[model samples]
Target: MALAGWICLAGHLCWMTLQCRSVSGKVLEETYTKWLKYKDDCLRQIQQDPQPAVGLYCNRSFDLYACWPDALPGTTVNISCPSYLPWVQTVQHGVARRRCGVDGQWVQYSEGELWRDISECEEDQETHTEELWMKQVMLSFRVLYTVGYILSLLSLLAALIILLSIRKLHCMRNHIHANLFLSLILRAVAVLLKDSLLDQHWSKPINTHADVQHILSHRAAIGCRTAQALMQYFVLANHYWFFGEAIYLHSILITSVFLDNSKCLPYFLLGWGTPLMFVIPWVVMKLLRENKECWAINENMYYWWIIRVPILFVSLVNFLIFMKILKVILSKLRADNKQRYPDYKLRLAKATLTLIPLFGVHEMVFIFATDEQTSGIVRLIKVFVAVFLNSFQGFLVAVLYCYSNKEVKAELQKCLRGWWRWMQTCWEDQ
Candidate 1:
């Protein structure tokens, strides 16, 4: 699955790069031709009449008596003239004919005007470099995601092998098997959808005006928006489920009473349903605001602040819960191994040093970083980080807990070995 995802992402990026390059090349050619024609006309006009005044038009203002000398044809020079045109002269030297005002009007000087208007010509060069950088960053992220995906898939596969090849690990205790199955299924779906939809060609190509309109329209853009919203909701739900697993584990270890709680149901509902509310508001705002883009314009910072507040609260709550659990578990473990093994203190220290940085500090940094950004590359990176953390959380938890247990590890190994042997034999026969 990881290999397939990489292949798909690579192909998509190549296609997008080709399309962007083609469009940029055409724009550059057209802009260059237009600039050449304008330059030639200006030069011809200047040669015919040396003192000819031309009007230079810009965004919201215009210069009426802009002069064009034969030496610098396409460029504007300051000119002084009659009652209508006011003039001011700067330092006058050999070749430097520096005059300030043009006609009677005080000419407005803009630094930006002095800069060449080569946006179209420079776009391909600029974007090509940007594209390469994006590709490299994306490739690194894809590799990271692929590793996580493969590990999760392997965990699921190991679980299947346990169920089929052995009885020990498959034994039903406190609905652990059911929880594992559901978690695996959810993780698989989340990874697959994310890898497929948001990977590379997520945004459609804007070839023509109609294509741009379609991309921004209510219907077409809704799907991408919906997918994004759904991904967010599922990610939250995945974490909620992992928290449930921890709670379940605690219940089993401390009380030995597994209370079947459907409390997770409401969480699941909110996780899926609440994001729909955000979507309605977004759609309404998009429609009423009449933006060319599908998503909310986010012109009002207040709207973003409002949206971010709840997410910030939820993240804080989750972080607190995680910290509290870690503290409790470590405290218990330390008390258990107080005197018999002095090295237990060393182990606990190592665990604290490792887990605190991995789980606690990392999550806090991610939450804060994500909340700081609006929509852009920063936001995209945040989404990627969030998804990666959420998807890999279950596997990490399983490893931290089950992998260290001798009985669990033994059962897993036996099951995997048997399954491998069977597959090897079958392959040999084939």
Candidate 2:
């Protein structure tokens, strides 16, 4: 029953793909058709070839990716690089190799997989240089974000510990901060897990004997898709939690009388439950329309917008609330600063700094911007800035709301002093 349902779903997706009217959808359909034609030609060639008459000869076959021919045991067969792939232009003169083992079967790349060694197909010097440079850039970006997230994760964990452990710090604001910290921690973890599951080097398909119809199945591993979905959920939660923080602050400033009885339940729901509204539909869209390769590539803008639009909307709302809060704060500061202007200035500066992270107003700069539309140094700079902002945001928030908060600092100091006195007293008694 389950298999039948999956077949029906797959048939529906194929029907949708064929009937798609968008230019990108048409291109995708054309590419798929071209691959099917190529596979048919390979299979035809394999069928027309004379069958092996005796022992010690590997059979002719098509491995869904490339065609293999009958060969003597222990001999390697070489074929021209396939022309169907986009990268084939660079490797026009290149060859793909596959080995036949002494046991009269195609030699396995691993215990259960057969492979064509396509390394030679990527040996063009000029193309290799370009790819190498791009790979180095990617490696640098990955390393930078990985380190930043690890630091942020560790810092946020410590902040959560402090906030949860210290009873004196228990308040609505601190509780909200703890939720924000937890969301950021989960986002970092999701990002790391998604990266690990879908990294190009690790997730690249192992060529094996399989039908062309199942090629996408090999590429789109369930684990990577699940990771991608989890990443989306956590990322949305992180943004909406920023929205929740803004709402919390706005309420405290604008509706102070209601604060004592306000519950964290609503904020929790906003932070965690709301992402499902966007992510579930986005996942369904990907599965039905653009199901390929870890759900990372944005093939259809409309489907991509399903997730991007909500994040932008939340950020914009947060920004507006932040501006209103700032205005109210400045007005109050002016009215209250008749006697102590310097202290007022300091307090205002602290408030601005503190609210910036809580509201996540920094995202306003590049919220509508994308790196893909740029080139050269502009693209590099945009990517770097985006990564730096995204990766270090939790760390900055933790520092502002927990590590550097005067209230938290005072509590830590008081705790340290008591522990020190206890140690001294025990020493004297001993």
Candidate 3:
């Protein structure tokens, strides 16, 4: 019996270590280590002490999940829920019960495995219903975003091909658009891959032994971490490319003629190279400080800010430049009458619409909103708007700048005429 107890304790310690390392990073890991150490000392003291009146009571021991004190025969022993459980925080004062048989041995399942009843730790019916509803809501959100990304992917790909195929459209402005399209494509792919990886590995029936083992194995897996890092890099790159677009537009309209060079090297560096600066450090910090679980959930705000701050900086800069651009456009419209530039107002409207999504100025609507800060309908609206904008921005940009551009339309018409002439010549030859 003593050997069995020792083995159970050892397994419990390993399980606790794995659970801690799977979530919330180093802080929870340290806390669980201290807790397991304390429990070990208590168990050791119990071993050193004399037996409790020989066979009149159940021996104090650790089960594979929790510790229990000695109890009189034919009685039940209850303890506070184990802190190592993922859901324990939701039921801080919950209890777990273990029954002692009349023979003074801890009860076991009919199949001969030890059982500890933790039903009290489970959520009540109301909470379970709420959880079900939340799951449904989240599933809807996932579907919506997945569809949006798919559509965006197709649109962005078409736009990129069109921009590349038309030689007349090859300029610094078009080069910036191509880079932006590429970044969005990569971002969409990364997000889909990351979500799929998580769903395949981490999404499972909670509290099952198989589920726990599955999570433990994948938590530190290189594939999961690599997916996470790529997601971060591409997300950052997408935002920086938005900045690149804004900067290029601002340079042409506002900056001196000398600054408006045809070379796209600067925009290329900004769009692709700049994300490495933040992503490498963010990866290092996560690996060193909070390395756990596909690097998706960070309890350390500082490490998260490494990725977030740069994106925020990009957004803010783009917004300011957008305002300046708007001011210039409005001033130009005011200076020129309807007779001077008859379609000036129409062109101004199109430019304004195009730049809004390109600059990501729409993000400011939910920039300050967070899961902690908002609840109820406000959070619902924020989430819906965020998902809609984020998923469809690529599509919107493709439509505004590529499919709807007069220059691209002219190029497409020319290509079609040449193709028609070639087809006619081939038909005559036949």
Clash totals in order: 5, 0, 0
Candidate 1 positional error at 403, Å: 5.7
User: In candidate 2, which residue ranges exceed 4 Å CA deviation?
Assistant: 1-39, 43-81, 89-124, 200-220, 255-261, 343-347, 423-430
Winner on TM-score (1 vs 3):
3
Return the lDDT, model 3, position 387.
82
**Per-residue lDDT of model 1, residues 119-201, tens digit only:** 22112455557666766765666667767766766665555444545565544332343354345546566556644543332
Global Cα lDDT for candidate 2: 0.76
Superposed model 1: Cα runs more than 4 Å off: 1-135, 157-188, 191-195, 198-207, 249-311, 346-362, 371-395, 401-407, 410-430
Residues 240-304, candidate 2, lDDT per residue (tens digit)? 98988888888878764322327888888888999999999999999899886567667678888
Task: Tell me the spans in candidate 3 whose CA falls farther than 4 Å from its real position.
Answer: 1-46, 56-61, 69-72, 86-94, 103-117, 204-214, 217-219, 257-260, 336-348, 370-377, 427-430
What are the C-alpha RMSDs, in order, of all predicted structures? 12.9, 9.4, 5.1
Q: In TM-score terms, which candidate is top? A: 3
Cα shift from native, residue 416, model 1 (Å): 7.4
